[model samples]
Target: MEQGLALGMGLDVGRREEEEAASADEEDGEVRRSVEPAVPLKLLPLLPVPRQPSPPLLRFPSSTATRNLDASTRGIDTNRAPSTEEAEEASSSSPNRAVSSFRTGFSAQRGSAERGGVAERASSILSDEEENGLAKKKLRLSKEQSAFLEESFKEHKTLNPRQKLALAKQLNLRPRQVEVWFQNRRARTKLKQTEVDCEYLKRCCRTLTEENRCLQKEVAELRALKSTHPFYMHLPATTLSMCPSCERVASTPATAAADHRPSSFAALFSKPTPAAPRQPPDNFRPQPPAATGHSCT
Candidate 1:
């Protein structure tokens, strides 16, 4: 009986513990339900559904529409209006006709543009030639005009604008023409002066060259004489003298007398013979001798 009582107490304790755990779990669930928000089913937005792709619709033209399209295409492809038979043929060979027609059209357009450019260029060139021909026309001056211009140029090499205008009026020529004539005259004068100066310089150069050549030849001849006759170069130079009273010819340093001197030492003491007197010319007459203080015996 005591054992049964103990087992019944233990069972009651276990049941009370289980009851406490269940109460705690219920409180937690209540707190959770109070904290969370509640939404109505009708207030929520619905998700969109993805659409599927549909196949494309194709509509083929009728036979009449096809014929009409071919006829229009052929008309555009050809330059002239196409007949019914040609249109049919073009339609039969549509691809080739289209290619050939495109090439021909492009070439024709290019040719036309090129021709227009060439024509424009030719016209411009012709206009330019006409303008240049008018601008560059040559005028001939009469003898009076030339003579007057020459006289004016002789007075003054250059002309003032007023002078140029006056000259042009007097000569019945344009001022530009007058100015050109003066310019040409000055150029011709300068050219002629330059030619004269050039000729003078050439003559001077030739003269100097000839002089130099002659001097060189003289130097060469002198050098040859020295080389050939070295003794003549070494010989002492001698000059001739005349005594006024006796009119005798005397050689200064006497080259011939020295040559005739003896080689022996004894000849140094020999008395030298005097040279003969020079003869007077046949046309000359001797004057009488002047008297001296002492008379000759």
Candidate 2:
């Protein structure tokens, strides 16, 4: 409140003095007051802030930027592409995979299959020899090879010791392999032969047994027929003369003797008696009834 009053009074007094001085032409008692102060002033220093160096500019080289730009322009696929198995192998392999190497591998495997097949086909010893003809040339036994072959051939019945040696020497294979091969071949042949023999025996047994059973049944039927008919047993021995074609028994020797024309005489026998001709007595006739019936019965 006091400060406000003092400021107001100072302002009023300055204003009144200015008004009185403007109208004081001959007045000796008029006083003038100034709104400006005439006191000694103290100076306060303004502080200056210390200057600091700016941070260093970070920048990439033009080549690096250009590389990134070019990479982007090419595409994400080029930058992030996955490598193939072949490519990885090529990179990792020491000597590298040559075209010739693949061919060699294929040929080696094919040769092995062919060799195994040829060695196993054993219908006859000769069959094996024939199949192995090329193999023999290919693996002819050197002295060392012969030793190996001999070692292997011991296990096989089909392969001669000489053949085994020849094969071993020519093949540049170990005697053990030759032995194993021959052993396997022999085993296979034996198994097949045994199977065939078993089948043959089974069939033979079946046929024989069937025939035997049939004979037994026939014997039983004959016994039954004899028991059923008393007339069949009472038949005369002459009546037992049998016709070869139909096996019908004849009733009497006279009829049987008359029927005894040879097969070549069938044409005459088959013809009927001629009406115009009178037949002469035949030279052939039965001896005593007992003798005539002997051969016929």
Specify the highest-TM-score model's number: 1
The number of clashing residue pairs in model 1 is 0
Query: Where does model 1 exceed 4 Å of error?
Result: 1-136, 234-297
Model 1, 257-287: lDDT tens digits are 4344222211221233244344453212222
User: What is the per-residue lDDT of model 2 for residues 47-71, given as tens digits with 9 covering 90 to 100?
Assistant: 1111122222113246544433433
Indicate the TM-score of model 2. 0.29
- Give me the displacement of residue 48 in model 2, in angstroms: 99
- By TM-score, how accurate is candidate 1? 0.35
Q: Highest lDDT among the candidates is held by which one?
A: 1
- The superposed Cα distance between candidate 1 and the true structure at residue 247, in angstroms, equals 36
Q: Report the C-alpha displacement of residue 26, candidate 1, in angstroms.
A: 99
Any idea what lDDT model 2 has?
A: 0.35
Clashing pairs in 2: 139-170, 139-171, 140-170, 141-166, 141-169, 142-169, 145-169, 152-179
Evaluate residue 251 in candidate 2 and report its C-alpha lDDT on the 0 to 100 scale: 37
